[model samples]
Target chain A: MNEHSLTAEIIAILRKAPSVALFSHVSPDGDCLGSMLAIGLALESLGKTVTFFNPDPVPAGLTFLPGAERVQQVLPQPKPQTLVFVDCTDLRRVSLTPDYLRDSIVVNIDHHISNQRFGHFNWVDDQASACAEIVLSLINQLGVTINRDIATNLYTAIVTDSGCFQYSNTTANTHRLTAELIEVGLNLALIHHNIFDQKPLAQVKLLQAALNTLELRAGGRLAVMSLTLEDFQKSGAQQELSEGLVNHARSIQGVEVAVLLKEVGPQEIKIGLRSNLWLNVNEIAAQFGGGGHKRAAGCTLNVSLAEAKQGVCQAIEEGLEIGRDH
Target chain B: MNEHSLTAEIIAILRKAPSVALFSHVSPDGDCLGSMLAIGLALESLGKTVTFFNPDPVPAGLTFLPGAERVQQVLPQPKPQTLVFVDCTDLRRVSLTPDYLRDSIVVNIDHHISNQRFGHFNWVDDQASACAEIVLSLINQLGVTINRDIATNLYTAIVTDSGCFQYSNTTANTHRLTAELIEVGLNLALIHHNIFDQKPLAQVKLLQAALNTLELRAGGRLAVMSLTLEDFQKSGAQQELSEGLVNHARSIQGVEVAVLLKEVGPQEIKIGLRSNLWLNVNEIAAQFGGGGHKRAAGCTLNVSLAEAKQGVCQAIEEGLEIGRDH
Candidate 1:
C-alpha cells in the first residue's frame, strides 16, 4: 500500500475496508481535530462508515470544528480493517484503542517533524502547515466535495497552525493553500475569534497576574515572566488559560528574547520561548532535550520551577550571543 | 510653507519657529497618537521647544504607548508660528489647538486618500499606510535623530494602520518599515496588548451581547450582528471599544459578507462592512457618502436604528450584483 503518499495511501487502505476508525492525538488542537473531522466528514460523504476517536475530551475552544460531536473519547470494538490517525505520530499519544484493533492495520498522518514512524502506513509531512492541510490534499485528490463545512474545518487548522499567518513557519505553500481555502469561502473572522478571541474572564485575570510579574533582564534585552502553581490556583487559571502571557514579555521594547516558565505540576516546569530576532531558541531547547523552530521553541524540566527558570536563563544567555547586533 | 514638497518646506518653517504646538485627529487611534508623539519627541530631542496637545483624554486602551502622559489635554498659551496636525483630514477633527494658531500657518500631514487639501501647507500622502510612515520618510529627509522612543511610537503607527500587517493595505514598505522598527527594539508585545488584546470587562460583556444576536443571511453568505445604544450603555462599552467587533460578523461559516451596525448617538448609527469573496461592501457604503477600500469600509447614517438597518440592507442587496466569485 502506498501509505507515504498522502492521497494514495489513505485511499489504498480504505479501498479494502468496509468500515474505518479515525482518531487524533489527545489534548486536541485545531490541527488535530480539524484534520480528523474534515477528513471524517469527507469520507462519510463517500458512503464510508467512519468512527472518530480522541483519547481525551476536546477543549471547549475547539468545539466549533465540523463533526466535533461525532468524535468519541476511545475507539470501540468491531472495528473495521482500517484505522487512521490524523495529527498523531504514535499510538502512545492516543488514549485508548479497541482491544480487537490493537493489531489492526494503522495509518498515521501528521505535520510534526518529530513524528515517529509508528504505523503500517505513515504519511508525515511537516512542510504542510497542519494535518488539515494534508487531509485536504488527499480529499482533493480523491475528488471529494469541498463544501462550506469542510472548508471551515480546514481553515481552522491552517489558521491555528500558522498562528494566524504571523509565525515564521508560514511558507509560500501556506499562503497558496490559504488562498484556495478562501476560494472555498472560508470565514476568516469567525475562525480568528473562535480560536484566539474566545478568552474567558478567568484568562484575563491570569494575564493580570502574569503582567504583574514581568521582569526586565539583560539590560532590557530579555523579558521574563513566570507562574507558580500557587499563582495559577489563586487566579483560578488552568494551564490552557495561561495562553498569550509570554507575548507580554516579547512585546516589550528592546527585549531580544522573552521566556515563560510555568509550574505544571509539583516539581515540573515547562518553558515557552519567543524572540524578536536571532535568538536560536530551537538550539536552546535542544540543549535541554526539547526542540522546535528558530523564532519559537520550548522545553520542559523535571526540576522545580525555580531551577528550571535558572536553566532556561542560562540557555537564553548563551543564545543571546548569537542574537545581538547581527 | 510648501508642505507637500520634498523641498525645504516644513524644514524652513521649523528652523525659524520659536516653539511648536502639535495635535492629532479626534477619536485618536494608535496611528494618530503615535505619529504625532514621535514627531514631538524627535523635535524635543533636537532642542526645539514643543508642547503636544490632545483635547480628548488618551483612550484608556492606548495609555501604554510611551510618552502618553506627556500629551496635554489643553495646550499651554504660547504664540507659535506653526501648528502641525497629524492623521486627520478635516479641521473639525483637531483635538487640542490654540485658537491663535488659526491665524498662524497650519501644516497638515495625513494619509487619508480623501483629505480635502484643507491646510495652508498640507502634505497628504495617501499611498502611505499611516501618517507615521510619512513622518518617518520626512524625518529621514530632515536628518532628525530617531531613537527608541521615536521608533516605538512610529512602530505603533504602522502596526495600527496596517492592522498588525493583516489588512489588505499591508505592503512591501509596511514590512520593510516594521523590520526597521523591530531592529530599534520596539516592544511589540506591549504594543499588541495595549492596542489589540486589552479588552475591558464591559467590552467583553458587550461582545457577548452582540454575539448573542448573530444571524446568517443572503443564502448563508452574509452574517450580521448589531448593537443598540442600550447594549453599549448596559455594558459600559465606549465608542472606541468597538474596534474589532466587525470581525466577529465575518467569522461565521459560509459567510461571504459581514455587517456590524452600532448606535453612534441617540438617533444616529455607524456601519462597518467586511466582505469575503462574492460581496462588495465598499460600494454599499459609498451610497451613503462614505468611502473606503474594498474588502472593508464604514459609513454613518443620520437615522433611527430601525431605518438605518433597512437602508443598509437595501444597499447590500443592491450591491450584490457586482460581488466577485473569487
Candidate 2:
C-alpha cells in the first residue's frame, strides 16, 4: 500500500483501539523517547488510555521532555491488546521478550532502514529524518492539535536524530515539519538548552581525558583517541559518557579515519570507527566481528588497550591505503 | 515601508543596476560570506557585472564556498555605481572609508538588529535568522533559479548563523527557506562537513588545553576555563582559535555563568562571558569595560590572567545572587 493509505490505515487502527502500549528502544535516545511520548500524548488527547514503557531510564539531559516522567521502566501487568513500538528496528531492540507480542496487534513505527517489519502493521520510513516526523503525520491525521508539549517532544526527536539538521538524513520535509513544530509555540531556546547545552560536568571531564590521549597516525589520515578505565574513574564519568568522543577525532581536518578505543574492562576494549570521506570503517569493524554503516561502526576487543589500539590502527592504516588506490 | 514592498523595491533597484559591488564585514563568517556570494551569483545570472570585496581574507573553512576566490581584499579603483553591503551592521563594519560610498548608490542588506540602515535602499530584517534569508528572498524576487551553487551558499549562511538551527533566531521562516534550498539539490552532508566538521588540529589542541583549566566556583554555578599564552604556544594555535571555548564552560549542567580567559599577551587577558538561564552576563561584562547581549558578552583586562579571573568570578557571583532575589 502507498504511504498515504498506510498512514490512513494506521490512524484508523489507533483510533479504534481502546488502549495502546507504547514501547521505546533500550538505551532510548531523544528520537525514540520523543517519538513514543509524542504519539502517546496524541492518543491520550483522543480519549484513549496510553501507557509508555522503556527498558532503560531516560538520560538526565532529556528529563525536561514533557510526559517523560510517565515512561515507566517496567512493563505493566496485563499488556494492552494493541502494542506500538516506536523507533525500534525490531522487537529485540526493545530488550523485551517476543512472547508478549504474540497475542497483541503490533504496530511498528520507525525511521531505521534496517527495520525488520516485526509489527502486524509497520510504517517504516527511512526517508523520514526521525520517527517523530511520522508521528507528527499520524497526529495530524488523528485530528489532534499539536500543543506545546507534543511539539516539544516531536521537535526534540527531529533535532536530536538529525543532529540539529546537520546529518545526511535531514531532508526538506524535516525542515518543513520543524517549521510547523516551531509554529506550535515550542520554546526552542529552552528546548535547545535542555537537550544540547546542558552537558554534565563529568562528560566534559571525560572529554578532556579522552583528548589527552589523542594520537594521529597514517600520515595524518587516521586519528585515534582513547580513554582508559582510570581516565573514566578520574573524571567520575560512566562508560556511556564517552559516546560522542569519537566524533572529536573524526572532525579533525585532514583525518580520513577516526578511532576511539574505550578500556571498558581490565582486558576488554570497545572500539568506535568513523570515516569522513573514502575509507569504509564498517569493513574494518566487521573484521573484528563488529559491523554498522559505512561511515560509522564499532567492535569489542577482548585484549589489553594497547593491543586493541595497535590492531585497530593497523587495520585502519590498511583501509586508508586501500581507499587511496580507489 | 513594509518588508514586502521594501524587498520589491530593492529587487527593482538591482534589476536596473548596470554593475554591482558586494562588500562583506571584516572577519567574515559563513553567514556574511555565503550571503555575499549567493547574491553575487544571482546577479551574475542576471547578466549584471558583479565584484565582491571584503576587508579581510575568507577563513580557510569558508574557502570552499562557490565564488569565494572572487572576494577581493582591495576595493577597485573605480567602484561600481551600485555598492551593496551584505551582513554588515554599519558602514564602518566593512572597515572601508565612507569616501567610496559618496559616489555610489549604497544598498544595505543585513539581519542584525543594530543595523545602521546606511543605505539609499535598506532591507534589514532583524527577524531573519540569517542575512542569507533576506538574500534568498531577493534572489527569488530577481527571478533567479537557485542552482546548487547558490543553494549551497545560502544553506551555509542559514546553517552557520542559526547554529545548525539550534539558536533562538531560527524561525518557521528560516526552516521554510531551508526547505526550499534543500529542494535545489544541495549536498547537505558535504556542506555540514565543510562548515563544521573540519576543525583544525591546532584548534582541537587548544580546546584540550582550555578544558584542562576548567574550574567551578560560586557553588558550581560559575564555570571558568582559561588559556595562558604558554597554552596557545604549546597547542600551536592562534588567539582566534579560542573563539568557542567559552561555550564549553557555558554548556555545563549547573553552570549559569561561564567564562573563558585567554592570555593574549603579557599582562593582557581577553574575557568571554556566557550565561545560561538568568544572570545577565552583559551587565557583568560592562562592569569590566566590556558589553554585549544579555546572555553573552566580552571584555579585556590589562591585569594578569589570575587577577582577571578573580575579578570576573566575583562579579558573576554577585550577578547570580541578584538573579536569585528576582
Candidate 3:
C-alpha cells in the first residue's frame, strides 16, 4: 500500500460519475467482499445507483453481510459507467472480467503495495490493514449513515484482514475504528463467527487435505503444505478452503513460519503465508510480485506447483535470515 | 442465574474459615477451570489461602489463562478448613481425592439442574450458563478490582461456556455481564482465539480422522463419526483433540444433527452431540445425566464402544424425529 489522499481521489470520481460498479479481486475474501459492499452501501446511502460487482462466488464465509446477496457477477452490462476496483492491485485479479473496466471510468481502491495504478483514479494505502479502512475514512468524510450493519460490515473487513487486530499492521487508527464500529452495535461474536466459524464442507475437506500434507521443518518451527487440484477434487473442496489453512499451519508448535502452496492450475501456484508472532511474510509475497502485511501476506507465482514450493521454501529461509540479521 | 444471592452464603463460609481450597470438576472445561480460577483469583486477591485444585491436567487449550499454571494437582496435604467445589454437581467429579472433603466445610456452587444437593450449602441455579457466571457475580458483589486480566479471564470463561453467548441460556444479564467485561477492555479476539483458534496437531489430525469417518444419514440431515484412541495415537493427539470435532460433523449443508463418539478408554466412550440452528442437543445429553445448551451438549458412557455409538446414534435419530415432528 502506498499512501495518497484516497478521500480526495474518491470524491473527485464521485463528482465526475453518476453511477458506479464496485469490484474487488476474484475469489473475494472478507476484506475484499466487505470493502466492496461497505463502499457500495455508503454510495447507496448517498442516493447513487451503485452496483456492487465481483466475478467469483463470494466466499461462503462472508455471506452474512447485509448487501452481500446484491453483489452481482461482474457482467460487462452496467453501461459505460464508473468501475470501482477494490482490494485488487493487479489487473490479473480481474483477468476474467478485465473488459469490465477496460472502457469504463476506473476508480481503484486497495491496500496492496503491488497494486499497479491501472485505474483512472488510484488510491492505494499499503499501510492500512484493509481497503475498508480507506473506505471507512471516505464514508466518514462523506458523512453517511453507518448503521450497525454497515459498521459490522466494515468491522468484518478490517478485523479479518488484520487478523483480528493482533497483526502488526493494526495501527492506532485500526483500534480507533474498531471502537467506533463496536459503538454501532456489531455483536462481536456474530462478526467473528460469520467470518470464521462458518466454513463449508469443501473448506473443511480442503483443510483436512492440507493437514494431511503438512510437512514440519526447522525442527517443527516451520510448517509447509501444498494442495493440488486432485486433492481438491477428491475432497470435493474449493479454492476458498485454502484461505485460512496457512494460519492453521502456522499454529503448529515451534512453527514460527507456515506456508501453503495452492495449485490454481497445472502451472499456476497461489502461495498463502502466515507467521507466529514474527516473520515478515509480505517480503516473501513481494519476491513473487505480490505484497501484503508483514506477519501475514501472500503472492502468486507462475511456476509448476513443485517449483513454486521450492521457491517459497527458499524465500522463507531467506526471509528468516533477513529477519534474524535485522 | 435466576437472580442469585449466593454472595452472603459464600461469604459466611469464608468468614468461619482460615484456609480454603477451591476444587473444580474432573476433565475440567473452560467454565469449570474459569470458575475455579476466577474464584481462586478473587480469593487470593482478598488475601485468602486458596489453592486451585484439580483432578486432571488443565486442558491444553486453556493454559493461557492467568491461573492455569497455579492450578496444582491434588496431593497429600493438610485439608482447607473450607472447601468449595466450583463446577461439580456430583461428588464423583472430585472423586479422585475422596476423603479430602469428608470433614471439611463443603460448599457446592453449580448451575446444573441435576445437582443432588451434595453439599452443606448448595447454590444451584439451572438457569445460569455456568458456575463461572455465578463466580463472576460473586466477584462483583465482593467489589473486587476486576482488572483487565481478571475481566479478560472471566469473559473467556463466560464466552466459552456460553457458546460465545449464542446458546439459548444467553439472557439480558449474560449480555450485561459480557458488555461490562468487554467495556472493561477485555480483548474479544484474545478470548476467541484462546478458546477456539489455537488447535494442536493431534486435534487437527483427530479432526481429519473424524471427517474421514463421517457418513451422512437420514437424508443427509444427520452426520455421524467416531474417533478411536488408535486414531489419536496415530496422530499423536491427546484426549483434548476431541473438542469441536462434532461441530464439524453438524455443519454440513443437509445436516440437522451430528454425533461423535470418542473411545476414551477400552470400554468407556466420550460422546459429543451437536445440532444445527434448528435442533436441540441438550435433551440428548440429559438422557445420560449430563446437560448443555441447545446447540451443543455431551455425555460420557461407560459401555462397550460399539454400544455407545449405537446408543448415541439411536438417541440422535429419536431427537431428529422429535425435531421433525415439531
The candidates score, on chain A by TM-score, as follows 0.84, 0.92, 0.72
Instruction: Report the candidate with higher lDDT, 2 versus 3.
Output: 2
Considering only chain B, report the TM-score of each candidate against the true chain B: 0.82, 0.94, 0.76
Rate residue B14 of model 3 by lDDT.
Answer: 68
Q: What is the iRMS for every candidate structure?
A: 9.0, 1.0, 6.3
- Once fitted onto the true fold, the runs of candidate 2 whose alpha carbons sit more than 4 angstroms away are A287-289
lDDT tens digits by residue: candidate 3, A16-38: 56677777777788898888888
Q: What is the lDDT of candidate 1?
A: 0.74
Best by DockQ: 2
lDDT of 3 at A195: 60
Model 1 chain B scores worst on lDDT over the 10 consecutive residues at B1-10
By DockQ rank, best first, the candidates go: 2, 3, 1
Clashing pairs in 3: A1-A113, A1-A126, A2-A126, A89-A115, A221-A254, A221-A255
Q: By lDDT, rank the candidates, best first.
A: 2, 3, 1
Residue A324 CA displacement from its true place in model 1, Å: 4.8
Clashing pairs in 1: A189-B251, A190-B251, A251-B187, A251-B189, A252-B187, A253-B187, B221-B256
Give lDDT tens digits, candidate 1, residues B195-218: 654445455555556665666666
